[model samples]
Target: MGLACAVAWLAALTVYDVRQRRLPNALTLPGAVIVLITAALAGRGAAALLGAVALGALYLVMHLTAPSAMGAGDVKLAIGVGALTGAFGVDAWVLATVAAPLLTAAWGIVGFRARGGGATGRIAVPHGPSMCVATVAAVAVVVI
Candidate 1:
């Protein structure tokens, strides 16, 4: 039930992100809180919180250093995404965190090329979808 909810939450966020290019705090924050609590009940609170902090911090740094490339919403979304993967263990968390940017970069490169390579000075690819995908993928890998 919790897993299904998380999947639906991520799916909704993914759709919103692709359409609007923003991950609203209302959704992201609540999801994080729910997942964190769930993780705690599941006896993985500390590690889950650490995962949230770790991935959230990483995205925060990216947002701070390159605001154009990373958004504040993505930073917020990372917390929940991290916790989801973190519930499995460090391996899932690390894999999700590492894969997110790579997936986003791939999207950026492919999108840039598809757009004729220089129509805009920068590609505005949203990172939330990639983050969500990475979390799902990592958890799937770890679990199966």
Candidate 2:
């Protein structure tokens, strides 16, 4: 059940990010809640919350320091990212947290080079997809 929810949640958010370049509160806000509810049922609420808070804080700082570099939607998406991967353990949570931004940065560099976004001052990459991908990869690591 948890796995299914995570897969569906990741898929929805990823598609939204790719197409819209933003994660709607409609998906991100409720996603955190759903992840927490399932985590609580699994007796990992504390860890799950920790993941959400940690990742959210990281993205929050990134968004605060550089508005163009990271968007508010990414911060919001981090909540779900944290909870889902955090439930697995500190390892999973840490991996997801670290991997997401690294993935985004890599993609940003590629996109910037390929399409020439240097004139725009910043390379725009949808971070929600990175977060979603990292969470799924981390969870898979823990599960298998």
Candidate 3:
């Protein structure tokens, strides 16, 4: 049930991000809260919640330091991701992190090819969708 909810949440986030190129805190905040509470109740403990917050902060720092590479929206979305993956433990977080960038790179390469290499740098991608795919793939790989 938790996994299902996480999947749906990621899907909704992806749609919103793709449409608006922003991940509103309105979505991520509530999602972070809910997932954290759920994980705590399910025996994952408060550590997961703290981990999520830390992850958000880490992303925030990256966004501030390299705004061209990271965005506020991605930082916000990381809150929910941190909660969900942290509940499962470090392996999930590692998988998601590794997968997200690799998948993003792959998508970027494909887009570059499709565009005849005209996009010089930092093409705006609907990264929420890429994250969603990466998160799901990570979960699948870890679980199966």
Best by TM-score: 1
lDDT of each: 0.90, 0.88, 0.80
Give the TM-scores of the predictions, in the order they appear: 0.94, 0.91, 0.88
Instruction: Using lDDT, give the best candidate's number.
Output: 1
User: Model 2 — TM-score against the truth?
Assistant: 0.91
Model 1, which residues run further than 4 Å from truth?
119-122
Clashing residue pairs, backbone N/CA/C < 3 A, model 1: none
Tens digit of per-residue lDDT, candidate 2, span 117-141: 6687466688888888888898899
Candidate 3, number of clashes: 0
Q: What is the model-wide C-alpha lDDT for candidate 1?
A: 0.90
lDDT of 2 at 126: 83
**Least accurate stretch of 10 residues (summed lDDT) in model 3?**
118-127
Candidate 1 lDDT at 130 equals: 93
Which stretches of model 3 miss by more than 4 angstroms?
119-122
The count of backbone overlaps in candidate 2 is: 0
What lDDT tens digits, residue by residue, belong to model 1 across residues 20-103? 989999899999999999999999999889899988898899899999878899999999998888888999999998998899
